[model samples]
Every structure is written in C-alpha cells, then in structure tokens.
Target: MQKYSTILLVGVVVILAATLAGVLVFMKNNPAQERALLPLVEIAPMEPDSAKWGVNFPSQWNSLQKTETNNIDTAYAGSSAFSWLERDPRQVILFAGYPFSKDYNDDRGHMNALEDVRATKRLNLNDEDPKRTPATCYSCKSSNNPGLWEEMGMAEYDAMSFNEMTPNINNAIGCSNCHEAGTMRLIVTNPALNEALEAQGKDWTTFTRQEMRTVVCANCHVEYYFDGPGKYLTFPWTNGTRVDQIISYYEEEGFSDWTYPEAGTPMLKAQHPEYEFFTAGSTHYNAGVSCADCHMPYVRDGAAKYSSHDVHSPLINPEQACGQCHTDVNYVVGRVATIQEQVAVTKIAAEDALIDAINAIQLAAANPNADAALLDQARALHRKAQFMWDFLSAENSTGFHNPEYALKICAEATNLARQAQMLAAQSVNDPSLLTTGTYYTTP
Candidate 1:
C-alpha cells in the first residue's frame, strides 16, 4: 500500500509540471492576443516647441537633437555642411534658369529647414519685403503645414508669401509634419503626392507601416516642381519613377523651367530625390529597408524603447544602424567607403564629358549659318545628356546605394553626351573647319 501511494504521488507531480509547460508555450506563441487586452498609450500633439514634444517622446526627441552634430559622413550625403555649388560648378549651367543654380546647399537635418531656408540666399526675400515667398516652399519644411493648409485652404496658403505668413507658420519640421495630432499615426498631408498615387491607381490609405516609414521622408525628399501661376507643388511621378518616364511626362506636358542662353535649350530642373534613389537601390529593394532603417535607428533607454530621429548617415553609427542586421561593422564600412570612392570617380569623369558637350553645343548655337537641323540635333543630344548627368549626380550618395547601377548611369551619361556632340558636328555641312565660338558659359 505504501509503494502504490508513492507511485501515485510521482504521477501527480509529473502531470502538474506538464500542464505548466503547456501554459508557458501558449503564452509565448500568443503574446499578441494576450497583449490585445492591454490599454493603448495615449499620444497627443504638444505646442510648437520641440521640447514639449520631447517630454512625451523623449527617445525620438533626444535622437533628433543629434542632428545638431555635423561631423558624420557616409558614402554620400550626411549631416556635414557641404557647399553644393562649389562642389560642381557645372551645375550652375545645368540649372542656369532655376533658383537652385543661384545657390543650393546639401540638406542637413529637419531642424535646420526653417533656418536654412531663411539663411540661404537663393530665395532673395528681404526682411521688409511684405510679399512672402510661395507657401508651397513650406510643404516639406514643417509639420504646421497641414494645419495651415487645412485652416486656410490650398489657394490661401499658396497665395501668401513667406514674409506674410512667417508668424503663422513658425513650426519647422516636427512630429506634426508626418503624424496625426492626437494619435501620432502616419498621415499623408501632401495633396500632390496623394494625387500622383491615385493617378497610378494606388490607395495611399492602404500603405503599410514599412512603406510609411520611408514615405514620411519622401514627403520632402523627392523630385518636385511648381505648376501653374499659383506655384502649386507637384511631383513628376505621375507616369512613373524612372528617369525616362519622368522625362517623357515633362516632354508630353511641354514643361520648361527656363531657356539656357548658351545652349539655347529649354531645361527642366531636377530636385533632390533621395528617397526615390534609395528605393531604386539594393539596400531598399532587396533588404526591405526604409529611410528610417538607416536614418532613424531604434534605441533603448533603460526600460523604454523608441526610434532615433536624428536623420543622417547610417555610417556614423554603423553598430546601431546597420551592424545589428549585417553583423560585421568593418565589412559594412568598407562597402560604403568603396562605393563612395567609385561614385566620386565616375561623377568626375561624367562631369568632364558633360562640360565638353555643353561647350560644343554652345559653339554650334553661336554659328551664323548653323543648319537648323544640325542645331536641333545638337540641342536634343545636349538635353538628353544633361538629363542623364542630372539623374546620376543629383543622387548625393551614388555608389553607396548601388555601385554597379551608379557607375552604369554615369558611363551611359558620358557616352550620350559625347555621342550627342559628335552627331551635332557630323550634321554640320563643314566638319573639318569647325571654329570655336565665344565660350562665355561659366562652369
């Protein structure tokens, strides 16, 4: 009877242990379902002061403060201050008709948007000038944009100049820029982007969180141009996001920013499309990475976790930004450095070739008996070549994104420009006695 009782006790203990194990496994696998009953964190928009926003989201705000540090560098664009105009003067000619040609600088952090715009000489707005610049300019530079647009309507917002609306649009790029006021949920405030997406049969409402992470930045970092007299903001992606597709759209619509005096070609200026170029690269394409993946890495502070919003180069903090996924800091650094070097070399070569082509076209244009057909051929070549150059060069960090793709674009651009020049010369009746005309264009 004692032996039977002992056996019964052992069996009971085993059953209890088995039941406990099963419960643990169930909880592990169904964590989401268990968490579904928990209360949600309430997040609301604070005053325009970034400090107040920081109180609610300390991690995001603290990370954002890092943008003040301008020492980091990556394969391409970073937090460092760069004189974009001095880097390549050929841009002056390429953007001869646009405000960018006058003065353009590399984008720093969102924190600098308001001050940078005010300090940059390109706008030419005087303190006393009551006529403010177009409200369209503020679209990408602030979170208050949506609030203002919603309150005043698009027409009223566009009608007001910078000086006129300075007091009202005080908030620079911040939480409100990409999120709803009370919920902090991602929202699309840009009408132009929404329209473009709809035109392509895409529903912006259904964009996944991964897409939104990048699209939020795409709100500002994209290729855009002002349309009509109201200077309504526009993105050229109505047809598609490729170079040729955008060019075709521009051609079909007869859009021309300004006519170049030297080359005598109507030119279309290409804005910074960082997100667009990133989307085309392997990091984004294959790895399913977003701008936030590199720019805004996650950080843990004690028990709290939040995304770092110091949007800059991942190269600065490879261990946190990329090494977490890649596992080898040295390998990631080497890859980025090699890509940057290759892009720089390719860019220099392409620029040299472009300069030569531009000079040749200018010479052809100056000729008194320049055959109309020959001149047209030269102009077409210059246009195509310029577009290619712009596409490759506009990407601040080229090879880092995709070395092979970047090099190919540069090589193709160089060839196109050279061929265009050669074809122009051949079209002329006299090939041997081509005399150089005045070279007044500054590069």
Candidate 2:
C-alpha cells in the first residue's frame, strides 16, 4: 500500500508543475503574439452571408443576431417599429422640402436597414433623376461599405449613384460593419468619419474600448449631411457637438438643407443624435457606461459568455444590465421610468412651442413687406425650438444614461428655443420689415 501511494504522489506533482508552466506561458504570449495570429480580413463587398463572418468572431456575431428579436419595447425606442409621421403630422410642414416629410420611421433592428430604406418613401428610384440621392446613402446601411471602399476607393464610393450602386450594397448591417474579422477588433471603416476625426485633431484609433462600444453606434446615429457632388458623408461637429456650436457652424458655412414652406426658414434637419445625448448624460459622464453596457448586456449560455446585441431598452433586461451595476433593481427601474416621463413632458412642451413659432413665421411671410430681417429672426427661433424637440425625442432612454446632464441640456435647449420665438415675434411686430410673400397654410 505504501509503495502504491508513493507512485501516485509522484504522478500528481509532475502533472501540477506542467499545468503551472502551461498557464504562465499562455499569460505571457496571449497579450501580443496570440492577437497577431488573428489577421485582419477585409470582407468582400455585398457579402450577404453574415454567417461567414460569424465563424470568425462568434461572440460579436451572436450578439448581432439579437437585433432580429422584436420582443423589447420602452417609452420611445425599442425593437418594434414606430411611425414618426403618425406620431406627429406637423413634421410634414417642418420637413416640407425634405424626403423625410413623405415618410420617416423611428429606427428598428439593424437587420432592417435594407428593407426599411427600400420601403420608406425617402428614396424615389422611379424618378428620372434617381441620382438625386447618391450612393453615399448606403454608408451606414451595411458591411458592404468597406468592401466597396476596397474595390473602388473612397472617391468612387462617394461619387456613385444609388441606382448604380444598390447591387453592391445588398448586405444589411452585420458583424463586418463594425469589427475587423481577422483581429476581432473594432474598426472605423467609414472614410468620412476618419477624415472628420482627423480634421478635429483627434485620433479615433486611440479611443478606449468602452468609447469604441458607443462610437460604433455614433457611426450612424449622429446628425450628418452630404457635402459637394461626391455626396461625401459629414458630421456637423465642426464647431462642436453642442446645439449652439452646430448651429453656429452651419450659419458660418451658410449651409441650408431645405427651406420650410410654412415657416419660410432655411431649415436644418437634425438626425438622431443618440450617442451625443447619451454621452452628455450622467451615466456616461459619471460612470463611463458605454452603450454596450446597457444596450448589449452579457448573456451566459452554459460555460460560454456573449453580449446580447439586441440593442434595445435596458429595461427589457434590467436584472442583467442595470442590476449588475446597480444593487437595487427597483430603484433603477423607477429612475428610468421617471426620466422617460420627464422626457415625454418636455418633448410635448417643446413641440407645442415649435408649432407656434412655425405658425408665426408663416403669418409674417404672407405680408408683401414682411421684414427679411424679422423673417430670419423667426426662422432662427423656429430652428432652435425644433432642434430642442428633436434632441429629446431622439434620446432612446431619456436621462437614464445621464439623468442630471440630459435634463440640464434639455432645459437649456427648451429655454433657448422659447427665447428664439420671443425674439422673432418682437422682430415681426416691428414696422421696419421687408420682403414678405404669400402666407403658406398647412393642411
């Protein structure tokens, strides 16, 4: 019995030493050498099969699949589709000269990009000048963008027409859109964004992983406009990310996307600025919570761990998302609900103020001798007011991401808008008015 026990002990000691050595080697080699083994694969254009990329990075692909699930809903944004037009028909007058007036729905699943763009009234391919909307429109819609960039170069990618380029943009939003398959690292494939960041004297590559998580969403969720004949994608963050800064930038550039028929203001369209709002909020400001933290919480499947890429409300899985960071689930839920309620109330107030401002502008525009200066004042006020309303509405989770900051920004925006309207009205009432046309009426 003693002889047998001795032999067993010797075998155990040898196994333990070997295991320890193996662990040490793995730790030393993994941070650099192992990462190098993961080569960066440039995905081909219009690679419709997401599963192909899935084989490379199972985790990101698995998370992305959750986007297809339509189970979650919150006060505003969710997995389900919501009609912005039906919610507020006044948008028609606000966006009279834009395609968005005809049809614009709130964002749905990333998977729906191709279908939503196709179905929406924004793109009128049947028109004689289909090129009115350039191929640059597809920049945010799919993984195929990088592939096109590779094949035709950035200049050609921006210059192609939608009708001429639709076939190459068939792939919907997927893994390769945000991740470099070879390295499984996040990459900014949009040349426009790269140039914009560089112009701002910022290196996008230096962004922390947490920042990258939200930056990926910002690639599509921020306010942008096309520049020049190439339809070059551009973010109006030249002046700054703040409302005043962006407005100042546009004014300085003399940029006017369209003129509101009713308001008679050279109006600027505000696209969804989800990342901007979230970044300004308390959670992002204080805790540094990235979008992935709440929107794409982790899920455990057996022994494997993967992020839930549903990209919906954190409320849907509060236990996993909020509860992990917050000890009390009920408190977190209550906070989210309260912030949403406040957002809704503020949204309504801003919308009412905006509509009123629009009405005032239309009335003033009708006078043959209406003051161009006065009209400009009213238009500025309307723009400010509309911007505030759109900012709040665009925030998917209210101030849950940063309650204090979001509330303050919203309040400031609201006050500025109201002030703009008052100034416009004062100008309209003055006798020194010029250049007025027939008053436009809304249906």
Candidate 3:
C-alpha cells in the first residue's frame, strides 16, 4: 500500500510541474506579444488630424485613402463624380426650385465630402449672399463637427453661416468620428443621431456590438432635413423610417424643402436613407449583417486582422465583402444588377406619370375656370407622388438595398400621380392633360 501511494504521489507531482511550466511560459511570452500588437501611437479625443490616428492604425488609414480614387464605376452609379442633373434631366425639373438643381453631383467617398462641398456651385458664399448655405452642410463633411458642436452649442452652431463655421471644420471625416480615443472602441459621434435614436425610444448605448458596427455609419448615411428656426439637422423619423411614415412626419411638421416651380406644391427631398432602408427588416440585417460587414470587411495582415476602411461599393471586393456568406459571386452581382434595373425602370415610369401630373396642374393654374377643390386635390397628389419617387431617387444605393420596397414606393408614386393627372384634367376641363405630353420640354 505504501509503495502504491508513493507512485501515485510522484505521478501527481510530475503532472502539476509540467502544467506550471507551461503556464509560466505563456505568461512570459503572451503579454509582450500582445503589447507589441497594440497601436504604436495614441489617439486624442476629437483629433482633427487624421494623420495622428493614421500612425496608430496604418492599415485602416491606408485603406481610407483609397476613397480619393474616382476610377471605379458600377452599373447605375459609381465613385466617379458626375452632374446628377446631366445624367437625367428629369432631376433638374424635379428639383427646379431647390439648390440641388443648381449643382448636384454623384457622391464619391468619405475623402471627397469636404472637397466636393467646397467645389460645388450649390453655395454662392460670396459676401452678397452669405446665407446661401447653412452651417448644417458641414455636419457630414468633417470629423471636426463634434468639437464644433460642443464649442458653439447646437442652436448657435446651426444658426452660424457657412463661412462663419467653415473655419471650425479643419479635418475631413476620419477615425475620431467613429471611434473613441485610447480605447479605439466604436461610438456614435453625431449628437443628432443620438437624439434621433432617443426620440424612437432607443438608447444608443444599449445597442449590441454588431448593431454599433452599422449604427456608426448610420450617423451620416440616413436621410435628414433641417428643422426649426436654426435649421438644425433632424431626421424625419418621428412616425417611422417607412416612406409613408416619413411623409406623415413631414406633413405634421409642415415641412417643405421647396415648392415645385410649376405645380406649386410642397416637396420632400430625401437624403441617403441607406441605414433606415437596409435595417428596416432587410434580409441582410435580419441575417445579422451590418453595413461594416460588407463595406468594411476584415482583411488579414500576417498575424493581424483589421477592418478595411476603403469604404465604397461592396461589389468592389466581393470575395472578402460577400464571400463569407454568399457563395456565388457572379450570382450576387447579377442579382444586384437586376434589382437596380427593375427599380430604375419603375422609377422612370413613376417620373413620367409625375411629370404629366405636374403639367396638368400647370394647365389648371393657367385656366381661369379651373375648380379650386380639384386643383387642391391635384396638388396633394403631386406632393405624395414626388415624396415617394424622391425617397427612392435620392437614396445612393439605387434600390439594391431593398428592391421590393423601392419598387413599391415607385409604384405608389405612379398610382398617385396618375390619379392626380385625372383630377387636374377635370380641373382644367382638358382631357389632353391625362395623356402623355413632352412636359420636360414644355417649360
């Protein structure tokens, strides 16, 4: 019994020593390697200089610089900037009373936001018209916005003229905008986004890590309009993110971007509503996919992996962007193209119907014997039709995010405009108003 006990004790001692030795080796080596892997430089809060943050995250910074390239072109639109009006003259007629008609262009990337705004003829910033553009224009253009918002306060900051606030915007969007200093954790920078989320009874901090991945981009990517006496940036999400819900919110607020030149109806201009559109029960979002999942897919660098920040079309890097879930690359690309084509077709059809409605209304306006009630009905229909069409049109995705929703929106626009046309014809006592005419060419 003593011999057996001695043997067991020896075995136990040997096992424990080996385990201890292994643990000691790991403790000595692992922490040093981990420290070495950490960011070399420290980032400061709201750092205006992206270059400083670049030092700590070279791969991400390097990738971000790729946005400067305007070579890539997709099926419907691309990074290469072009006059939106020239691409389709119908847009000019649609935005006839707004500044967008003056100089709207295809958005390139994050790098170009500031540069594009500066170069755009949208704002006549001469001393003659200092209020040509609002300070809110810089909201999405720079990472320096948060600091400016803090210093000037929301009301004062929003009320300042474009020139008065331009000096405060020193840096274009960068790491500081979407990340916390020191920790480098993702965070929501835009206060307006936070307020918007709060209004929906959502606490931004309560969002999971995966949700934050998309929420970071949602800060600037969603549709918004200037509101109140200060022209403060506000999301049209009081009712909901849906087309009709957003329209209802606008109607309740008595919001009008501009009156249609000929139709004389209030208009609702949609900014890019990608986040709202995609996250509103989209297949991708439902499947736990975030914008960063595709737009900023993880890439490996020897012993390290980091989210690539070359944020542009996911189609540009489908293997890394989409291959994780979608097996067939060609099938996915083909599917997106088909969806876009379908949406485009319906969009044009809707626009044609809307233009006819506008023409009919114009005829009614010119006619002395036009019925007031019928004219009012025509005006209301025009507002609804344009709101639907513009919601899809201004969205940067071109209906790839949610094709069914886009098509439905356009279909509703068409139906409403057709109804408006019939009413306008009755108002003006002209059956020709119900038929197709060269409306864009007329005025």
Candidate 4:
C-alpha cells in the first residue's frame, strides 16, 4: 500500500513538471500584447497625409487636429496668429531691411504651418527674381519634405523656387515629420538636423528614447541658415549652439541674412530657436525634463494614456503640464508670467540700445570722412549686438527657457551696442551719434 501511494506522488510530480516546461516554451515563443502589437493596416514610409497614419493612431490624430482651431492666447505667446510687428514696433526698425520687418506674425500652430507659410507677407512669390523665396523655406512647413528630400536631395530641392515647389508640398506637419512609420518611434526626420548632429560628432541613433523627445523638436525649432547658392538648410551648431558660438560661426562664414538698411551693418535674422535656447543648460533639462514634458503632457482617455498631441504653452494647461513636476502648479505658472515680463522689459532695453547703435552706425557710414577702419569696427559690434538680441527675441519663449542666460545675453548685447555707438562717435569726432531714445524721438 505504501509503495503504491509513493508511485502516485511521483507520477503527479512528473506531470506537473512537463506542463510547466510546455508553458515556459509557449511564453518564450509568444510575447505579451502591447499597444497595437500588430497594425490593422501597414503604413507606408513617409506618408505625408496624416489621415493615412491616423488609421493606426486615431487618438493622437484627433488630438493633433485641435491645433487647427484652438487659437488660444497666453500672456506673451499663443496660437492666435497675432501680428508681432504690431505688438512690438521696435522690431520694425531692428529688422528694417529684412522681410520679417514687413510681416512677422506669431505662428498659428503646427497644423497651420503650410497655410501660414503660404500666406506670410514676407514671401517673395516672384520666381523670376534671384532674391525670391526658395523651396528651403518649406523645410519646416511640410510633412511632404522627407519624401521629397529623399527623392530630390535637399540641395536640389532647395535650389527650386518656392513658387516652383509649391505644387509638391500638400500637407502641414504630421506624424512623418517626427516619427518612423515602421516602428512608430520618434526619429530625426529632417536631413538637415541629421547632418548637423553628425557635424557635432553626435549620432542621433545612439541617443536614448527620452533624449529623442527633445532632440526631435530640434528638427524645426532650431536656428538655421541657408548655406550657399543651393540655399541648403543647415544648423549653425558646428561651432556649438551657444549664442556667442553661433555669432563666431556666422562671422567665420561671413554670412548675413540681409544688410541692415541705412546702418550698412550685415545682420542675422533669427529663425525661432526654441530648441537651442531650451537645451542650453536649463534647470528642467538638467532634471531630465523634455520640451514635450511641458508642451505635450500625458493625459488619460478611458483605459488609454498618451501624451496629448495638442502642443502649446504649458500655461494653457498648467495642471497637466507644470503639475507633473512642481507640486504648486499655480505658483509655477505665476513664476512663468513674472519671468517673461522681466525678460520682455529687459529685451526692450536691449532693443533700444541696438537702435541707438544702428543710428550711430548709419551716421558713421554716411560720413565718407569717417575713419573707415573705426566705421567697420562699429558695424561688426552692431552685428554682434543685434544678433545676440535677436537670438533671445526670436526664441518664442520670452526668455522663460533660461531666464538667467537670457538676462546675461541681454546685458552683453546692451554693452556691445553702447560700445558700437561710442566707436561711431569717435570715428567722426562727433558726440551726436551718442544720442539716446532715438526711436521715441524719431517719426
């Protein structure tokens, strides 16, 4: 009887072991289900129309569509497409010779990129003119870029006139602008950004997923210049992304977007440089926070939780945006307001200084008897001062990205402008160039 009971126990143990082994094998062969483990439809690479990609990600697409109509206003910036030129007329004189001075409206949002670019008064639609806008302007305005760039090469694509290239660009920013269709992972979709990263000896592929969130924004939100006759898009990160470093790089290349009218100083027009500003050793960045962390906070819908696709100011949704890191959301929002206001006021001071410098330089240039060498020195200083100021002015964040850095740059810019004005006066042996409040007193 004892031997029979022992035999039954041994048989049960053998059966359980075999079943466990089979379960382990099955689990190894079949992985657990994740968010849409298999696509209901296979998306083609570089699909420009977002609706096709929306088939796989309805929530993100639906959320993204809201940007088209959600034109909310914040204290400094929002999606209302307000004319920045009207809000700050100082920019008019600052950018006098550039197209931006004529028409500089705040961007409506990502969804309206194509429409806004088409409508901007700055665009010279005449294809026959050599100074007309090129297809390079479409670099950040369309989802169709990746495929077009792949087929045509960026050099050839940018070589075409904007009017000539308009037919090919049909979609505004979409999933393909920043994602891989095959894996649905964030990627460096802009070839210019890819090459810039390489120029810095950094590989975007080796970057971690979190890093990609911020770096991906660099695709469109960076300060770039059109290189050479091809009007090829290029980021000025070869020297380093700092404001001073960027000035050095531009000086080395002897590049200027346009010559400041009357002032005769070569000037740089800063494209929105949100990426460079935010990544320049900010507190949030050091804390491992990303641009998307504040701008694209995660929200829950039923059982699904995903980062909200309606990208905008964090002040628009402080609870979901600032509440994630800071315990006091309201306090943080208040801080942003205070910081932005301070920066705005300080920025105006810098602008005033720049105007004075331009005024002095203009006087000096008009004086043929003025020491040519001294006049050239004044022009160089004016160029550096104005570019530094524009870097902060065009950043779009109103200096909240890095308040200390912003103020530091502003102070430096003001000093440079004053020095430029003094040099201009010394060149002509006249103190008239040292006049202040020239803008207020003029016209």
Candidate 5:
C-alpha cells in the first residue's frame, strides 16, 4: 500500500509540472506579440483625417477608401452619382425656382462628398448676395465639421460663407463624422443632431448601443433646413420625424425654401430623410435592426471580425449585408426590388398630380378676377402636397426603407394635389383648368 501511494503522488507532481511548463512557454512567446498588436499611433479627439485612424483599423479604412471609386449603379440608386433631374425631368418643373432644378444629382459615397459638393452646379458662390450659399452647406460634406463646430460653434460656423469655409474643409466624410476618436465609439457628432434629439425629450447619451447604431446615421440623413438669415442648420424634428408632424413643424415656422415659379406657391423641399423614414415604424427598425446591420455588416479578416465600412446598396453585396440575419438572401433581395418598383410607380403618379395642381394654381394666380380667398387656399394645398411628395422622392432608399409609409405619403400628396387643382379651377370658374397631364399637354 505504501508503494501504490508513492506512485500516485509522483503522477500528480508530473501533471502539475507539465501544466506549469506549458503556461510559462505561452507567456514567454505571446506577450510581446500581443503588445505589438496594440495601436501603433494614438488618435486625437475628433480627428478629421481618417488615414490617421487607419493605423489602428486598416480593414475599415481600406474599405472606406474603396468608396471613392464605387461607380456601380443599381436599378434605383447606387454610387453612380447620376443626374436625378435628367432621369426625371418632371423634377425641373417641381423645383422651378430652387437650385435643385438647376443641378440635382443622386448621392455618391462618403469619400466623394467634398468633391461632389464642390463640383455641383447649385453653388450660389456670390458672397455679395444675402442668399449666397452659407458655410452650413459644408455641414454634411466634410469630416472637418465636428472639429470646426467645436471651435466656432455651429451658429458662427453656419454664419460664414461657403467660399470662406472652403479652405478649412479639406477632407470628405471620414471617421470623425461618426465616431469618438479615442474610444472609437459611435456618437452624435453633429451639434444639430444633439440639439434636435434633445428637443424631442430624448437623451441620445442614454440610448443603448443598438439605438446609437441607427441614431448615428441621423447625423446627416435627416430633413433639415436653414432657420433664418444666419442660415443656421436645423432639423425639423421638434414635433416628430413623421411626414405629417414634419409638415406641421414647417407650417408652424412659416418656412419656405423658395416660391414656385408661375404657381406663386411657397414651397418646402425635403433633403434626404432616410433616418426619419426608416425610424417611422419600419419593420427592421421595430425589430431592433439598425442601419449598420445591413449597410455595414460584420466581416471577418485574418484574425479579426469588424464591421465593413464600404457603405453602398445592400444589393451590391447581399450575401454579407442581408445574409447576417436572413437565411435566404435571394428572397430578401427580391422583396427590396419589388418594394422599390412599386414605390417608384406610385411616386410618378404623385408627381403628375402635383404638376397638374401647379398648372391650375398658376392659371388661377394669373387671373386678375379670381376669388382671392379660394386662390390662396389652392396655393396652401399645393405647398403641403408637393412637400409630402418630395419627402418620398428625396429620400435615398427609393422607398425600400419603409414601403407602407412611402405609399401612404405619396397617396396623401396625390389626394391633396387633386384637391388643390379643384380649388384652383373653382377660384377661376374654369373647368378646362382642372385638366390632368397639363405638363405633357402645356408644351
């Protein structure tokens, strides 16, 4: 029995020594390797240059650089940066007095933002004019803004002219636009976003990581307008992000982007409202899916998994974008195609109705003997109807973000437009003025 106990003790000692030897070997070989993997360079707070951040995150930076050359075109929208005005000339009539009628193009990728804004034909470069393009125009086009806004405050920053701000803004949209430099956490970088969220009685700082993924996109992808002669950038989200709520906010403010030519109606133009449209009870949004879930899905590198920053249409790479949550990528892609096509058709119908309303309103406004009260009412309806239509039109998704909301907004626009046409005809007491397709028939 003493010899058996001695043998068991020897075996236990051998096992412990072997385990300790293995642990010592691991420590000797791996600590230096792990230290070498640490970030080589530290990032500054709100760093404008994404290249600097690239030292720590090469995969994300490399993918972001690809956005500069992404010229692929989808069935509806992609990174092609095609002319929205040329594709749909009805837009010319819709935005007769606005710069959008002169030069409106589809959106490109983030890397092209500064270049695209500089190249656009819409720039009112005459700093001498009170209506000259304010530096607020550069708000969404550069990564330099977060730093600038911190230094100058958004009010003073927005008060400067676009040309005055030109030399200051060198880089396009980059890491600083959406992230905190040190921690690399998502944040509400834009001051307008901070104020807008606060106005809604919601503290973005208290929001969960999942909510921030969607809210961070709202930094730029929202409906905003210049508040006064100062051209202060402001989001029209005080009342809410819904179409009706947005219109109510605009109505209360008595804001008008421009007066429609011939029609003489005060108009409101929608900037890209993807955040508003998607968060308004979209299925994915309600299901806790964020904008990044599909647009910038997780990708595996050699020894790491990171979210891809190559932002573009999910259709371009549905396998990675849609396949994370959905098993059948093909079916999901088909649904997007179907939803966009349906919305596109409905959008065109709304456009036609608005044009008919504009024709009738113009004729009524031109008539000296028209009923003043009825003519004014017709103009009001046209204003609301066109804004409702433009809300769906200006959004980048082509209605795929929220199909039901898109269709509903378009239907409301069409109905209001038809009512505007009727009121205009009644004001002038002319049945011929209520004709449909006046755009096609007028000349």
Candidate 6:
C-alpha cells in the first residue's frame, strides 16, 4: 500500500511540474499586452487564398499542404500520376470514340487537381476556341469556383465556356471551399449537391454531425452529368444510387453522353461514383462508418488531436484508418489485395468481351445484307454491357468497397457483351466469330 501511494504521488508531481513549465513558457512567449493587441480578422467573401486562412489556423493549413506529396504507393493505388492507357491498352479500345480514349490517368492527390487538369489532353488548349470543355469542369478543381459562381449567377456561369472561367479559377481547393469563415464550422459550398439532396426530399440540416463530414466531400466527388441545355452540373440520383437505378433514370430522361463512333450506339460514361457505392448498403455504412472516418482519421499532434488534413488513400495509413475496426492489419490488407486481383481478372474478361462485341457490331454494320432487327438488338446489348463495365471501371475503390457487387456487375457485363457478340456473328454470317475467351486485336 505504501509503495503504490508513493508511485501515485510521483506521477501527480510530474504532471504538475509539466503543467507549470508549459504555463511559464506560454507567458514568456506571449506577454499579456501582446496577446491582447492581436487583431480580430474580418474574413471577406470569396476569399480563395488558403494562406490567409493559415494565419489563424496554422495546424490545418500546414497539414493540408502535405497532400502535395505523391510518393506513397500501394498494391493497386498510389499517389503517383500513372497513365491508364500506357498500362492497359485495352482501355483505349473500350473507351474509343470518347474523350477518355484520348487520355486517362490514375488519379493523384487532391493537391494536384488543378495542375493535372490543366495538363490533361482531355481539354483543348486552343486559345481561339475556348469552349472545348465547360465551366462545369472547374467545379471540383478550385476553391475560387464558388466565388466565381456567386459573382456570375449559375445560368451565366454555366453558359460561359471553359476559357472564359479559367482566369478567375486561380486557387486550388482550400479551407474556404468546405468551412465557414471565422467560425470554421463545416458547410457545403457546392450548389449542385444541395439541389441534388433537395430533389430527393433530403437536406443537410436533417443529418447528424457525424454525417456532415462525408456530406461535404460528396459535393464534388460523386458521379455527375452536365445538363444538356445549360451545361449545368447535375447528379443523377433522383431514381436511386444503385448502378441499375441510375441507368434507368438516364434512360427515362433520354440522356446519352455520346454515340460510339465505331458502332453508332449511344454510350453513357460513368464518372467516379465513390460516394454512391459507399452509401449503397456497404457493411461499413451499415456499421455507421462515415467517409471521413476512414479517409480522414484522427491523429495526435503533440497535445492536440485533429482530423488529418492529408486526404489520400486510407491504405497509406491502415493502422489508424482501418485498425480501429479491424484487428488483423495484414489479413485485412491481404483480403483487399485479393479482392482487387479478382476484380482485375473479371474486368479484363469483360473488356475482352466488349472489344469483340464492338468489332462484331462494326463488321455487321458494314455488311449490307445484315438484318436490321438483329443489329438493333446487338446495339442494345452493347449499351447494357458498356454501362455495367464502365461502372466498375470508373469507380475509385476498384472492388474494395463492395466486392460482391463489383464482381456481379463485371460478370453480367461479360455475359451481355458475349450475347451481343453472338448476335453480331449471326448478322455477319460468321460462326467463327462466336468463339468465347478469344482475345481480338483492335484495329
């Protein structure tokens, strides 16, 4: 009993000494008059400079700068700017007749968003014609975008071409985009997300505090399509968040992004829909895992605990990101790798099937004696197959988010594309073309 009491007394004394030392250091560093003389900053509207915010919240701003690092790597994903086409030539044939065929890179850190977008071949650099892309392209690239949109109303902003808006969108995403000035409370800056929620009878105020962290990111990260008339950014979740449900909604609205130049069939390009997949009854979502919970896990900085501002793949810090729920880190990572491998195999198989279908359709379309009804059926199948394949392709998770659904989608895509190939073979009167699993070289 005496030894225990002595140890407790020593621990209390150590803590008290540390606290006294901290107080003396603070007092010496910041004299009372100097502390009182500090001015209260009045934040102005549309402030895009993150350095200005750094003056008051140095921790967050400094931490956020770490996103500039693109050195980290994982088994399937990393921070490096990798060319998708150079690694997988099959993507070129699959996305033929689309801007993606021109160039698609593996996504990098958010810090590189503006730089990468400016360098991408997807955007036309011709100064004479500034309308290659739309002002909507700046939606996710800059913090100044909200200010630009506010200065020019939605209609005028949406109407302006990409070049017209480029001069104003000078800042990369920063504090102002996701937080209220002075107070620093989280808030949604993107209007399209607000409208999307309202259309579905939901609003931000109705959500819990834990849910808001995820909600803010859902603003720009989800799949979106520009409304054809005004070129306004729109999220297609009115029908539902599932893959097929979104397809149905697009069909109902008669929305087709572009017609394939190879087969003349309308194609819908799926954007990165991470938010939708995460929320669609995933085990983590069911267990109340917020997007920020995994992606922005908390870390200790001296005596302070703050949500990490270095938002990148959670795989980079699985101990803090996944270890809270998962006990075995190796097992979980190995499982994720396994799932990714399976998804990759299935993805390739689906791509091979779709390539064959595209070739068959092109050949059948050229044959004057081909049956028109059979050609139409094959085109419809091509649409379905491409939609299913692209959904998995465009998703950032690869299959880790929902492995079962990912595999199912890929399997169905392969089946549909094979069926289309069979019909195309019949139309072209070539039985040899019906061979399955045979890889065909793209012309």
TM-score of each: 0.83, 0.84, 0.91, 0.92, 0.92, 0.87
Q: Give the TM-score (vs. native) of candidate 2.
A: 0.84
**Sort by TM-score, top down from the best:** 4, 5, 3, 6, 2, 1
Q: Per-residue lDDT of 151-217 in model 5, one digit per residue for the tens? A: 9999999999999999999999999999897677799999999999999998999999999999989
lDDT of 2 by residue, 1-443 (tens): 99999999999999999999998897664534233345345544435468786665565567777676664667766777777778766566556778888887777788778877777768756525734777777888887777778778877887777777887777788876777655556777777777766777878789998889878777787777787767778887776676567678777877777778866777777777776666653545557787788777777655445677556677777899887688999986887788777866665555555655666666667766666786677677667656656665666555565566566666766665556555555665743322222122222
TM-score of 5: 0.92
Candidate with better lDDT, 3 vs 4 = 4
CA lDDT of each prediction against the hidden true structure: 0.70, 0.69, 0.83, 0.89, 0.91, 0.81
Model 1 per-residue lDDT tens digits across residues 137-194:
7777776777777777767777666666777877678877776655556777777778
Q: How big is the RMSD of model 1?
A: 5.2
Tell me each candidate's RMSD, in Å, in order.
Answer: 5.2, 5.6, 4.0, 4.3, 4.6, 6.7
Candidate 4 global CA lDDT score? 0.89
Give the per-residue lDDT of model 3 (tens digit) for 106-136. Answer: 8898888888888888786763564467788
Which candidate do you rate higher for TM-score, 2 or 5? 5
Show pairs that collide, candidate 3.
Answer: none
Candidate 2's C-alpha runs over 4 A off are: 1-48, 58-63, 428-443
- On TM-score, the stronger of 1 and 6 is 6
Candidate 1 positional error at 6, Å:
18
Query: How would the candidate models be sorted by lDDT, starting from the highest?
Result: 5, 4, 3, 6, 1, 2
Give per-residue CA lDDT, model 6, range 1-443, as digits (tens). 99999999999999999999998898666534233324256666667888887776556777788887756867667888788898788888888888899999888877777888888888865646634677788889888877877787766787777787788788888887888775566777888888888889998977887888878888787888988767888899898888888888888888887887858788889888888877777777778888888888877676555678888888889998898789998899888889998998888888999988888888888888988889888988999899889888888878888788889899999999999998988977888767654555433
Model 3, poorest ten-residue lDDT window? 28-37
What lDDT score goes with residue 305 in model 1?
Answer: 55
Off by over 4 Å in 1: 1-49, 73-76, 126-133, 281-283, 430-443
